[model samples]
Target chain A: MDMSVLIALPVIIPLIIGALSLVALNNHGVQRILGVLGTAAVLVAAIVLLWQTWLNGIKVLEVGSWPAPFGIVLVSDLLGAIMVLLAAITGFATAVYSLKTVRKRFERFGYYPLLHLLLAGVNGAFLTGDIFNLYVWFEVLLVASFALLIQGGERAQMEGAIKYVTLNLLSSALFLTAIGLLYGLVGSLNMADIAVRLQQVEDPKMVTLVAMLFLIAFSIKAAAFPLFFWLPASYHTPQVAVSAVFAGLLTKVGVYALYRVFTLMFTGEVDFTHQILLWMAVFTMLTGVLGAASQYEVRRILSFHIISQIGYMMLGLALFTPLALIGGVFYIMHHIIVKANLFFVAGMMYRLGGSFELKQLGGLYKKHPGLALLFMIPAFSLAGVPPLSGFFAKFILIKAGVEAQAWWAVAIALFVGLFTLFSMIKIWNEAFWKKAPEPAIEVPAPYRNTALYWTTGLLAAMTVAIGIFAQPIYVLAETAAQQLLEPQRYIEAVLGGAK
Target chain B: MTTMMAILIGCLYAAAIYMMLRRSMVKLLIGLILLSNAANLLIFTVAGLERGVPPLIAKGAETVVGGSADPLAQALILTAIVIGFGVLAFAVVLLHRAYEVIRTDDMNEMKGTD
Candidate 1:
């Protein structure tokens, strides 16, 4: 099989399934089956793409047989492939979990198709080599997410969706403006071509200015420090399945874009740009953890933590060293699984406790020891406890920070870890260990859905597995980091050695 | 021509930001539309203006001759315009639904969800 076809399959499969599911909209059963099968197929294709990229270096596909810089291209490097695979894993888990959590009415109202479209957009974003195409993919992502965020049409969902849509659209406008500026300067939208042209740009300051534009635009999407207000406000309002996928995937796309552009296209002004990134990383970390500490709701606390963890990933990029980039990649992979699992557990907590508010919830440890046990795995991992995925991720980053003599960053990273632990313990004590102030509202047996538990358990197990067998994944992250730090290979692969 | 378009885009952006700062959600929508147009115009002016030499390749020519307008910028703007329209339509509907349910179009009042 052509490698390009293999590379394209992950995106194509989901879009086809999404359209098919929409055509069969009246049949909920068909949509459900299609959703599950579509994501599963994506998962399989992503794994193959990853394997192929690992074996054969970066794979570039020119759309319509047009040569490199002139045509739309899809390039898969190790980092892009890894992100796609993780997205597939999360997408599949959400699909299965949604079978149990999403109501039938929501499913009927194009939920399944939107979910697939979201996956398609995410996959496309990771794969595309053209910067303008990336913007289009982002619009695809935003449009689908807007619909999905307010799927149930609940008052709160609508409120959250409004903020989410408006802010994201603003981000899109910023992104488009930046692209226009970049295109004007470089005369090409191909990412590799831009990278090549950027080196010859006469005024580096102009490039830095555009880089700042990209930073601000992507930060809004990534939920970094000052711009992250929209995340905590809106993330907790969606259905658990939606929130889980959003938690795992959405902000990470923003981080991925940050990683992509900063490493690949914006390296000329690293001293200036990365210094700014360093400060943003510290502030984002502090603000997110502090926000999490103050939050009383289960998902709200988790939502804040997403911002905090994004700080760690950005720290990796800001450091711009091989070890730090490795740490960033590993942190991203670890955080996605751990964060999504935590949200899934929160959904189950809501199922059992009858409320998301911590003060109102209690005695889950006595009622469902198994549930409590499952929660502990991800909670501990998220807090960077020893021998878990988060711990390794944090260890590498802090170690890199120390090596770089970035004492302040290391100190803040360690300090935030402690606070993260505190918040995790807060959830544990309030939601599980504490005695109920009143009789637990009588409800049918809690969380008996096999699919829901399976999804959470699978993600939890992934966290544990990544921790225990950290060496292989670490090696992969190291290779990915090496590729990012040295972009010659990426550019050469995409442009067919034309440079 | 480029300077004129640049000033026009600047005015559109200033107006957009002003409206976006207002309390009404309707104003926000208008602001978004204006901002999007500003962005499209920015792309247009930045890519440079050319008189009616269409980008179409002449018969027997592999590509359009010199002095042809940059079609890529126009294509980009078209895509952005379509996306902007779709999102604007969605935002209008979303705001309408929000108004129907919340009984207020004030951005401040919507903070009740927080």
Candidate 2:
């Protein structure tokens, strides 16, 4: 009933499910119920969190009754709430989609348990207030993701998962090392506490180095620019449902953390970090769109676009204004929904034409117009077409860039949007409009005639709904931006520093 | 005693990083072990290297030391060590699988594949 419960519920319930399934790890029927129940509960919880945060302001749920600086705190600002909601929605959608996909697989119990664990990690990451606890949850998800990413023992899966695991393991090391240094220097792990303490110390540059270390770590996780190579290589090889949720979910967490840290922990004297972030944003946008260009494979393009879209989010960070932050927050929400829908549609394409390769795939406009309509809405939104969620988000960002008089960034971002349109069109023309792929081709059929369709449709519908109702979401983002910019509110909310 | 422990830990770090750069998977696993041990030593050093003094702080004592060993960092180090072990085990399994699947232990062969 309390607002704080909104934050804990999404994380705690799935963990409870995981515990239940672990106790019944041998029972297939029990695992099935756990999977559906865990994911649905999280989804409902996330929506509740969003509604509560919207109504009563940000919610801080301290793990123990201890004070904020020492206790692990889970604070759900509008930004955190939005991320939880997206993670929860995609999480449920993926759970539904995976049901049929994993039915014949030998390890359904293990699969559902890992899935629930992943949700817990994701929700915790979104909600946590302490920087050290962030590290803990990051590990929780990384370990779970490592296992989940390699669930199937096939050659391609192994190859892809190896790259994924190796890259992320290195990221974990970097993250842990940074945390050690931060704890050593500041002697506090709480984000709000650190923010306050960091100011009392005169040496801002040392803190800047610390911030840069974290930036590199989170950037790698988000797959930004130079650190983005692992994404395209591995993402396309996974089960479509898995890849869909991944595309929808994981990197957004990275972006979310980056935004949170920069706004909350490194405010006022972050010029150096912002400058570096600006250049990376430009490079990330260019390189990501370039990678998307000429890519024949469906998921490869989607993965590359993930990188580019992260650029826009980074742009919001680098620009460092209320509006830009709003743009960043809104962009991620738009991206999470649309990207997930695209990947789900790609799954559908895999079913129809048997390949995500643009060369092999063709006109689904005739065979599956209903699906075409669903895919087009998200795809068009991603391309920033008018009246879509993508347009409003990008509009705010580019306008903010212009207002900042960062003309070059605005131009580049706009051009990247065009190139994004080009890539989307390529997918459209090749995968949906061109002649259908030969039927004898060997790409395995995706599951249809079941819950997968409804789940995918649900995700696609969210993409549309966000577009149509952009006003309220924009208002929410503005509040999140305001809370982040000041940060005292977040600190006080968590610490009773206000009280 | 504290200074000597610091020196020993520094040596471990140097040796572990050296081993980590090796091309052999077995050596890399060893490197992880050494690196983690070095990290444990650092944790111990930070928590204050006491020769015979206990880790647990007594409510009343004859000594008047400014700071006791930080229980939290020690707890964190314990968690880290277990996580490191889990990761190392997973890596070892993966190495063995790679050997069985591709019939090789050389890291270079695994390169440039994906």
Model number with the top TM-score? 1
**For every model in order, what is the iRMS?**
0.9, 2.7
| Model 2 stretches with alpha carbons more than 4 Å out | A1-3, A23-30, A437-450, A497-499, B1-65, B106-114
Q: What residue pairs are clashing in model 1?
A: none
Error of 2 at B60 (Å): 7.6
Write candidate 1's Cα lDDT for A1-499 as tens digits. 5767788888899999999999999999999999999999999999999999998999998887788899999999999999999999999999999998998989889999999999999999999999999999999988999988988778888788878888898899999999999999999999999999999999999999999999999999999988998898899988999999999999999999999999999999789999999999999999999999999999999999999999999999999989999999999999999998999999998887788999999999998787899899999999999899999999999999999999999999999999999999999999899997586665556555788889999999999999999999999999999989889989999997444
C-alpha lDDT of residue A302 in model 2: 90
Clashing pairs in 2: none
